[model samples]
Target: MNGSVFSSCLEASLQGQAILNDNGEFLFVNRAFCEHVGYTKEELLLLSIESFVIYEANEDLMKKEPIIKRGMQQKQVEKLILHGNGYLQTTLFTVTDVSDLNQGYYHVQLDKIVTTFDDVDFSMLESKLRDRDEVRLPKKILDGIKDTIITIRLDGQFLYANEAAEKLFNRSMEELLSNDFWTYLKQNNDEELLSKFYQLLAGEEYTQFEVYKKDQDEWFDVRAYRSDDQVTLYFINISNRKKMEKELKESEMNYRSLVEKSPETISVHNGKEIIYINPAGKKLFGIRSFSEGALNLSEIVVAQDQARMRENYRMLLTGKKEMTNSVYTLKRLDGKKFDAEATTTLITFKGKPAFRTILKDLSERKKVDDLIRKSDKLSVVAQLAAGVAHEIRNPLTTVKGFLQLFQKEQEVKPFYLSLVMEELERVEAIIYEYLTLAKPNVESVFSKIDIQVLLEQILTLTKAQSNMNNVTLEFEYEQVPAIYGLEKQLKQVFINLLRNAIEALTDKGTIHVRILKHPDNQVCIQVEDNGCGIPSERIDRLGEPFYSTKEKGTGLGLMVCYKIIEHHNGVLNIYSEAGKGTTLEVILPASN
Candidate 1:
């Protein structure tokens, strides 16, 4: 390398470097060395080495140490020094005593700072131990161990044995020495142990396992390690520990069975943090897998009950209270809330105190409560509609007839006339819906109706309505034989369903109508829409009279559809998810 390049490399080196004379005074210094002490190159030479040294082993900075010059490699030492900002820095000092480093000056190098002791080559230390023959374990140390310790070879020749090994083999040391260790075996003479011994000698690694004792009816955990040229085997009796582990496993199985079989949801929590939840506990929280469940109890707790739940948790965790049962509303992962009665009891778990909670879901009871309230609302609306429906219809008809007459006249502004006609028709439809609810009168027009032909007609009727709302109507049909039903009634059922689907759409979407027939003479009609879906809780109320998701909906249209389908001996089912879509399936029996 060029001389200038070598000097530049030395200046840019991360290791701090400095050239010192025999007196350890700085003769020259690199940029890193200058930076190490927060001083420039010119100022560094003016300062003595003793100025940076926080602690020195030799005390005399100028004294020549034998280890520094005699060792060919760099000698590392625990060196602490003061930094540029007056703070102490721990560093690994690598000193090279070069006789002619630069004009006969010595080089002092400071490597990176590490919070560890000085680095020493461990291989060289190990080489010295390996240089000698076997270093025997003393008899005093050998007799003190409770484990059976033996020094053996690949050929099973015993070199040494401890007192425990002697008692185990039932032989004196004089008789056991130089004998094949396997010859004294009463139980374990399998090739598995022999293969392992050969592998050990082949320098695989140290291994430990459990084996049965032949001379004694017991199990021992065996440890095999190579020390120098010999392999040492240590066997410790573990029969009692093994028996205890088996009993513990049996007890755990029983505990697991009880937790799984219990009908009530059971969970254990340490304070507000949930530690364990059983299978039934997951279902009680309206979850199939608890992996996505909240790790803390507060997540599933309703906002209104969170503070009370926390208070109850705190009370149960401490000795202040032993038991508490409170009715709370629990929210599921899908944001559905259900009523639950939670019972908490303080108990010892895993050697520490914890709270055990049992939850009984009250969703069925909530539905019954809602039914009672909805029935009262329906009764009030029905009586009022029946009292006024007859008195208003005669005058509403006269007003609609006059609007229709003006809507056709050339002198009248057609736009205003059409607006009046639209409002009058809306009023007429609501009156008709209320009258139908008061007394449903469907004309019994039974015929062998082809569902495919009926759906095609229904689609044509709703296509314009769907297009006006920017929604597409998609129809797929698989033809089949006709069935006996009220054709006009079925047509009415589909019109209401398809129109409701189109109105549910918020943006450009599709309404799919599929008609298929089964081999068992049954026809299936399906209406699927890519619109706002009903929530899980409100799905059951979809076809109920006087209930609707739409703003101005009377809910009577769906109830009439249900009634029309019921008269045809057909079944209706709705499956939906919030914001996804809704699928309605109608399966009716086919006829010859």
Candidate 2:
């Protein structure tokens, strides 16, 4: 046969099977091939078989060479063809020898055309047919696919869904197709998402998005790809990932709030430098934003406390100490100082080693501590005063006795005797004031004393002095509970407070005293004055012996008053403000 006749015969015999050249350009295709791919014979010749397959499946077509080589060597190749309408078709090809006839001077014709389907069994034939049919059938392919696949129109209308998709959405394919795809998704009703969906229908492709199914009410991660006029989506449930992210955010917020509102100053330091500081720490350090290496721990601490702070930091860094809670003085940037109790611990912050310290301000506590020490010193002074007064009393008595004897003998002049007597009286007064500083016997002599009456008696004695000082004294008394105490001591306590009040008042100032019963069945006597009041700074030291503001003042008056009132099981409270006034309140338990 001629070459054209052989080519036509070979093409007509294979039915739907085709042939291709070495470059994969179609050489010839039979009528069956044209009908299977929805192309005419003339058109099929112009288009390569590779163009009919999907773009992603083009690689599979290129793999046909190896099979063709094997077939040429073994004489046959059975292959699957990808249909233009998105399917695979199995076909068989048989190679033949069509070598030219050229023997030096002339040509040697060794033409051969062979065809065989005898080796193809019925089962193999059936598999080929099935592969062809199944290629165009998505349901069959979807059932075999591992990932869940769903097809939707441009309007997000479900068209086709796989078994995995059906199971994940907890809905049948019919149900999914009946409703809008976004209706089942979480937050689909949100205005922003609804607008986005409209935009998606308007030719926008949503790549990887988060969606939720209506039936199961669960979330998924969806990846959508556009093909033709439809969108193919692949979904993966990511509820666990979403939940973890939410929990992490909440935990971070809680920790941040705790650090911000803590009463103590909190700071996070990387090595020797501060990285983060809380509000209290910022105020304590007198600066903001202490970034890396900006300020060292020693620089912020007071000079006297630097050694202790350094030691604590060293121990923390070396792991010799797990945590530290120590008190030290912290200096402000402005040079003001405050006592601080700092607690420190090692921590890792943002991939770097760091320490977190909490510092509590102890300035008010230090003031109280100083007062306690001063009070202790005053107690010693009181004891010394008592001893000196006792020692000097004997000498004063002997001197008075000798002066009187000399005056009677007429050896001493009258004026000298009078001067000696005046000196002796002054010495005696000093002894009396010193004796009041001695510790009082607290054992109560159980005698019911009308507190109002005792207060009136002391007030009458001080009225004459108040008039001399141009101070008006007023007293208010109510029927109050009586207390059992030494009458003489109680009177002395009243006199001492009254004298202090009178001295504190300027000319024409008023002194007010009120005696009443407290809610706890205790007797309360309050002495208030309108005078140049004590300063807050000096008020705490008012009761210490020998610590006086007045130059000629003994300062033992309030101290002795404190001792006497304490012996009577009473509490003394002094409230004063500079330029305001002063109030002294004494509370004593009532007798049963």
- The segments of candidate 2 whose C-alpha lies over 4 angstroms from its true place after superposition are 1-77, 81-148, 153-160, 167-170, 174-194, 198-206, 211-217, 227-230, 245-253, 287-299, 302-311, 375-592
State the lDDT of candidate 2 residue by residue for 1-592, as single tens digits.
6879866875675355556654334567767666655567776566544443322233453444533221243245444545443334444545432223531111111122232234547444433432342332344445566567887666566766777877876788667767766776543444433554564567766666777555466678867777666677787777788888889999999998999888778888864677888877887778855565677766776544554465566668877568988787777888787778889999999997888888888887879988987879988677886856755666577677767888789697677667667757767655676766654564655689988888878887888999999999888888887788899888888887888788878889999999876644677789999888888788779887667766546576778888887666566778787899999888787776
Residue 259 lDDT (model 1):
91
In order of appearance, the predictions have TM-scores of: 0.38, 0.38
Where does candidate 1 clash, by residue pair? 187-214
* Per-residue C-alpha lDDT of model 1 across residues 256-369, encoded as one tens digit per residue: 999988887888887667788888877666666555225667778865566456556655655545787778888876778888998999888889887888888888777887
User: Measured by TM-score, how close is model 2 to the native structure?
Assistant: 0.38
**Weakest 10 consecutive residues, lDDT, candidate 2?**
103-112
Model 1 residue 468 lDDT score: 89
